[model samples]
Target chain A: MSPETTVTFHTPSTLDEAFALLKEHGDDARVIAGGTALVVMMKQSLVVVDHLVSLASIPGLVGIDVREGAVHIGALTRHRDVETSPIVREHLPFLSDVYGRVATVRIRNSATVGGGLAHADPSQDPPAALMVLDARVRLVSPRGEREVAVAEMFRDYYETVLRSDELIAEVIVPIPSATARTAYLKFLPRNEDDYATVAVAALAEVANGTVQKLRVTLIAAGPTPVRAEAVEAALEGQSPTAEAIRAAADLVADAVDPMDDFRGAPDYKRDMAVVFTRRALERVLLAQG
Target chain B: MQLNVNGRTLEAEATGLATLVDVLRYELDLTGTKEACGVGVCGACTVLLDGRMVASCITLAAQAQGAQIQTIEGLGDRELLDPLQESFITDGGFQCGICTPGQLMAAKALLEHNPQPTEDEIKHWMMGNLCRCTGYYQIIESVANAANAARGDR
Candidate 1:
């Protein structure tokens, strides 16, 4: 057991109070939602803080609603909520599929989508899916609020552009076109409780039997979730045929620079990214048909 | 902090970041919830958080505040055991009993959520809780038997 330290815990009743706590504590305080990832890091002595402001007590931050033109998920919404959300199942099954496969049921029930994205683990599934979906995150601080694209939110390995005093309030995801199809695939040594060796999420729209638009993102193969623009370029304007998908998959091997580790070698992970991208594309294409 | 453990309310002094497993063993002296892997990966410290199975080793004690927590002590007394407990004893589901509490809690939670879980559903849901004894077949059968008992089938 680590030495006992005096750490103040503040559970604000409202968002304004939560922001005030963040503003008051600054770098000495950390916002805790679903402590799934943060608690583990704390136990490992990776991060130590004198104060923790829990966002779980804040109301209106645990619901998912699709209004107007976007799907808004509160920062405190758990992964299990996303996995079983009727709205997500009806409109964004790809996100649901990714959430269903994250960690395990125990973790999913407590791990929030905001915490997962804020942790910015390169091997995490949500960031890869959000990157491909071109999601936007809303950050709140005492000063004001600002929104940033998911792709730009990540700065490097296990790092995000989130400031110490800024808290992610919600994530706004633009609804995909009715013609669009998306899928997420990951490779892990064991099917349970293991991080992804390489994960791929692809979204594409087929029009007139030709690919009108495409987006591909790879995870665990780089410092952060990366958009495979080269692969997207290869697939756009091409027919949703096996040949086109194969060519797009081939482009991913060069687009990502994977690292060699116990999970797999760099070459193997890169090959897996290609294979996973191809399979995910094929699944989405067949679903459209 | 005051928590309703099993059926009784208890007050204890604990930090916000202290794990539920630590609260049970260290503060409350309910040592049934084992701590195998302190991380959430191992379900050896599984317990019921408001009747839902969760890895207590990873769950913060502060998170359990005002919530109902059920440990192995709440399952049954030595003389009178829950049906699931009886089933495990009869079906040889445990070898060393180190992971039994977690397994039973997870199985009990599964049964509560789904009375008649398919073998595949049980396998998929229980994948997070690992048993080094590798006696999953008997454990699954025990859970099924308990489910049957709960439904008045046996």
Candidate 2:
């Protein structure tokens, strides 16, 4: 750790000011919202930056409201706010379930939605559900803003497609169909709040016992959140019978690209991903019929 | 940086890099809040920033500016301990006592938000604050008892 060097901090009240700071510092600056992940890295000297721009004071970046047909969560909105938010629960309960499972109430209370996505922790819980929910993250910079689907946001481990000067402004999740049933199942061997060894998040629509629509995503199965494209395709129009679901669940094994770690061996995680994916599908499918 | 801590405005020097726990313990000398794990996993550094319980170790002092931060030192009055504190003592909530301050602050935030929190609620809310010695039943009891005392049901 560089004990001698101290970072310069700026609390900007507006997005323009914050963007200007990021533009000025460019690669040397890092935007911190909730600081749950960034500060820990900073403390460990893993991330050494000359300037720290805090988004906490930005008023426009702190809210959970409905916009159009989706729920718009400001980048700086804390996880706890999202978890307990009546709007979030009512609009997208899958999102609330995912956010509620992160770490604990204390970590959730401080970790911001934008910050969590920006941090790009693959093992974290939110991204998987956000991916299944077809959420889009808004990234703003001095130039302008652009939206990236949650599935396409992450580039690698602890990395995102976000440019150095860009800040995550908001997350927009289109509300699911009123009849769609969603399930988020996180396999945690240690404790309830611990990071999932392997987690499955899925939403399914059943029309006359046929798979009308399905979206599936996996966590801790790869460097980035893994969208189970194969599984989704397998069950899209098939009858959601146990036989069909079992065949679809097997596809998750190949779709996931996990690595060996404390959680499990890569093969073990892949296997568990298949099991949990099947479990999640069963839960959602059962909820319908 | 200037902060409204525990209902009193105080000035503290914090580098842009300093965390809220850092400024509170080192600069402001509010050592009641302890930093056990540098990460957000441990609840030892829990503090209330604008009435919301957050991990002080990860929260930047700069981000917490213009907000009210309450630590363990601010929980009780000069004359007597807060009812929560009294409950902790009477219910045998502490053994090592290292986690007491953070636990107290977390409990305070919980009760303020959800007065009369059920046992399930208390367990869920206080999950992050680890009490290595107390095995948690006592801490849960302490919070429930304190909630009861707050409502004058004790």
Best by lDDT: 2
- In model 1, residue pairs whose N, Cα or C atoms come closer than 3 Å (at least 3 residues apart or on different chains), thus clashing, are none
Off by over 4 Å in 1: A286-289
> Among all windows of ten consecutive residues in candidate 1 chain B, which has the lowest summed lDDT?
B50-59
Give me the candidate number with maximum DockQ: 2
lDDT of 1 by residue, A92-165 (tens): 78888888989888888789988888989888888887877888999987778999999899898889999877
Q: What is the lDDT of candidate 2?
A: 0.88
Error of 1 at B5 (Å): 1.1
Worst 10 residues of 2 chain A by lDDT: A1-10
Candidate 1 CAPRI-style tier: medium
Where model 2 places Cα greater than 4 Å from the true spot, the runs are: A1-5, A287-289
lDDT of 1 by residue, B41-125 (tens): 8788988887767788777888888788999999898899999999999998788899899888888889888999989888888
Reference-based lDDT, each prediction: 0.85, 0.88
TM-score of chain B of 1: 0.94
Quick one: best TM-score, which candidate?
Answer: 2
